[model samples]
Target chain A: MADNEFLGNVGGRTLSKPPTPGDIFFDKSFRFLTRAFTWATIFLLAFIVYKIGGKALPAFPDLGIKFLFTSVWNSSENVYGILPQIWGTIYSSFLALILGGFFGITIAIFITQDFLPYKVEFALKNIIELLAAIPSVVYGLWGIYVLVPLIRPLANFLHEYLGWIPFFSTRLSGLGLLPAVLVLSIMILPTVAAISQDAFKAIPHKTKEAAFGMGTTRWEAILRVMLPTASGGIFGALVLGFGRALGETMALAMLVGSMSTLTLSFFAPADTIAALLANTFPEANVGLETGALMYAACVLLLITLIVNIAGAVIVTKATPGGDRR
Target chain B: MSQTGLQLPQLERQPMEPRALKSIILSAITIACAITACIPLFSVLILLIYRGGKRLTLELFYTLPPGAFDAHGVGGFGNAILGTAFMVGIAGLISIPFGILAAVYLAELDPHSKISETARFCAKTMTGLPSIIAGVFAYAVVVLVMGHYSSWAGGIALSLLMIPTVMLTAEEAIKMVPNPMREAAYGMGCTPAQSLVKVILPVAMPGIITGVVLAVARAAGETAPLLFTALFSESWLSPNNPTASLAVLIYNWSSSPYENLIELAWAASLILVVLVFVLNIISRSMGGKTKL
Candidate 1:
């Protein structure tokens, strides 16, 4: 064969060569295109803050810091205060965090600690995840139709006998903090359980074996060793769950009764910032009221950002390699 | 001392010790807590089927929703369904390509770049963003700018909520593509673009599809983002006009004083749940099969 032909035929193909101009051009453009898209994603976050903050600027000067401390929200008179909503948001989410955190951690322990057969554990995990698949609006529907009525008797009893306590001072009135908290807890359950389960699963097998070898009972080992080992992750899960509860809108709107009042009574109507935004934004007039609602949204966004970012940081740090994905 | 010259302890069978008993009780408590966590799921499912299932007729898929004061359960949510499909489809179109390309950048082109790290962190943070804030965003950027609520605004809102989910999941899928596959492609003298388009994409298709389906499902059920962006309409949907959605329809009707409207809300809830659950199952099954 000729020298040129032999060169082309080496290794059954043409010899290696630098990328052609077209190849280089296409590759460079492809990289640029992908990079552009990535930047777009980051820009989206900034855009949200800019647009929301810009709209809320007018209200900030008008309402001042008092917007967060005053409770009355008279939209018709163009006066807006979100203190009650803020209080409800924090109070309901805190209660939900406690309820959801407890059950979620326990469920995670049960599933990860060989408490059940493999198939059952897998099925249970999926079932719990399915709770998250249900829409918030449907949860609202269920809350209104089923949960409220179901809890009414207990609420009545609490009011009837324990009415002296401020928490049960008022009637259930078909919508209140109690039902909202209950639904919110249920809503955050999947987040907490799923994250905590991963946390428990990430515990080193040797750690578990060491506990067993030390003659610790299963529960003792789990409580004394595994829980501490996964404490960071579990805490992260609770924080994330709390973040989710704080932002929950439709269900809380439907169940919390949309009343802007600060009270200790769990049976009394209450409002959350998210629910307030969802309820008011539609009917809010063109200028100041809309700005106020936007301001409330800004507040809600700030809170959730702080909470979710903290939670994400904790989760990342807790994972073994400091990278969850 | 025993015959073996070791101090052999007594081997008498003993009742359960306090620690063992405590362990058993705690284990039982864990089981109880698991069951308690599951109660809400079963309750919601059973109640949904019991109440919502009763209203699931064939007409529910093709009829317009009942009027606000309609005494009879005379209409369906067909328009809302179409509107939801339109908005979610628009959101999918907008988010999917952008998300995948971003994922490509993060996972393939510049895996360790600072920009990639920032983008990844932003995406993680965005996943927890309040859906309602996305509505406010759309309201400001799309609705206020356009001077009207439009399906486009709703789509924009949903797309915001969906992009993070898609990007994160797609990045994960791309990362799961083994290193040797890329090496093989490179060894074949293929350019980076060619390799990604022809080899990496095909391998990651299943995972990408699963992510897209999951994102779409989530977008479909979101009510807060659509509440103001779409701003429910009684008429049929158009891109420029405020459009109805099943979620908003349920929200509006669930509280209606009219019994029939309430029933229609239940039916809508049922349909939404089924749609979300079906998509979830599809993604789960596809995900199971795509395990590398």
Candidate 2:
């Protein structure tokens, strides 16, 4: 133990401290340790870029822009094009976003509107957040064993009756873009709703009072005033959810039929970037196959970066009192 | 105007009828959507019980997976259950210390520095990085060097996935420690380091523990990040050996073309969900407002 020494008088009393040598040693070492861990955050991002980029570089020269535009993939031929997968990612995410965003916002309104009992609202919200905690793998299992079987008949019904429409034209396998979209929508709802709920709650109480004072009904107040006021934050939340849907892997991989193709029919099976990596990285022969998978991952990373950045921008501009401002 | 006086008085006395009708429909829509949104959660639980309950047997936990042709549906998934625990335990060990320290730097040491901001931003953004990227990165770094897939690499990948969640949550916990606690420590001539370790940390322990539990739950259910890192195996797992996890096992089994494998998948799913659901309930009850 370091010897105690008189450091100061009258913090209303005399104060003792460790000797200067021990203090210096402890402070220096502690600071260095904390600094390294803190910088680990930065180092983490750089390392990801370095590792993925290093592996992806081999494919870039060989495929270039062609990689993004072509759809065929066969490891046996060492030929790969990710166009179909890209379409699958975008198409499914957009479909999921449209569904999740609409319902998520509505759910936010339902839970936050003060009509339900406090305990019920609280419990419901917790249950919804549990959706976020459920492993994607479990979700995949549920989709395959339960959701697919239940939806197969409905899909077939859609196909048989609505064959005139392109989306419903193809025979339903129950494990195609439609099921993938539904699963993603269900998966993302909590994210969208939670953040939207936060935005809705943050609107000044006085705004609600003002709307009511103007003779606006409960629905009028929520739709006309509340929705517009929180639209920026709501949009941000939706983008976040959509980004999540795109990155969703295990469930989509298991449910999306693992096919590589671009088709307008929602009944067709499809693939996404994250699902592709999850499905292929294990078996990737250490050559071009690995490079292509890494390239696909890089593309997914780029998409998330764009979405996150754009979300930040929209939220900052739209929200009344954003943190950055 | 002929009826202006009559119309004005009626408007003042009553709500707009059409508007009221429209509001009613919209309100119903909101409520309907809320119920619709909640259907998936309850349905998943109900179906899991219905299907997995029939397949649940004591042997499922004791025996290796039965092959697809087994008519009896005989074996258990003891290996996967234990493997998940071991891998996530190692991941928690790796992430917890670094996460706490990084959080301490953010909360106490230099909260406003550029590097601190970079750390905060990266941690925030990294939370959204696809789990597959973490898997690929781990494979690139650990598997490539080790010349094979291993549980060590899987744990490392899970640790990366966990660090952001742990750091941000711990930062919140530590920041919640009252300023007066630190001031009192300093009044006793304690240094910033002393105040942090002796006063702030103890005060923040509950919230930090909550964060740790949630992070563990998060890591335990992870499947994507372990794909290329842990790979998969049916046998008992060693830290340096390929191992199967409950999540991965469920994935492989559910996807198998055989009905028996699918039954095993449901049984595993039931166990995994129950474990995760319990952990999440504990975490939420501890910190009702903790960030997701």
Q: TM-score for all predictions?
A: 0.96, 0.93
lDDT per residue for candidate 1 within B90-193, as digits (tens), equals 99999999999999999999888899999999999999999999999999999988999999999999999999999999998998888899999999999889
**What is the per-residue lDDT of model 2 for residues A1-325, given as tens digits with 9 covering 90 to 100?**
1223343334445455464988877877887888999998899888898889888999889878898998888899989989999999999999999998898888899888777999989888988898888888888878876788888888889889998998887876768988888889998999999888888988989998999999888898998999998988899898888888878888898888879978878888888888888888877887888888889988998898788767766665666666532
Relative to the unseen true structure, what is the C-alpha lDDT of residue A121 in candidate 1, on a scale of 0 to 100?
96
TM-score of chain A of each: 0.94, 0.92
Model 2 interface DockQ: 0.68
Candidate with maximal TM-score = 1
Assess each model's interface with DockQ, reporting 2 decimals per model: 0.83, 0.68
Instruction: Point to the candidate with the largest DockQ.
Output: 1
> Where does candidate 1 chain B have its weakest 10-residue lDDT segment?
B6-15
Model 1, docking class: high
Q: Which residue pairs show collisions in model 1?
A: B64-B76
Candidate 1's TM-score:
0.96
lDDT of 1 at B146: 96
Query: CA shift at A324, candidate 2, in angstroms?
Result: 8.2
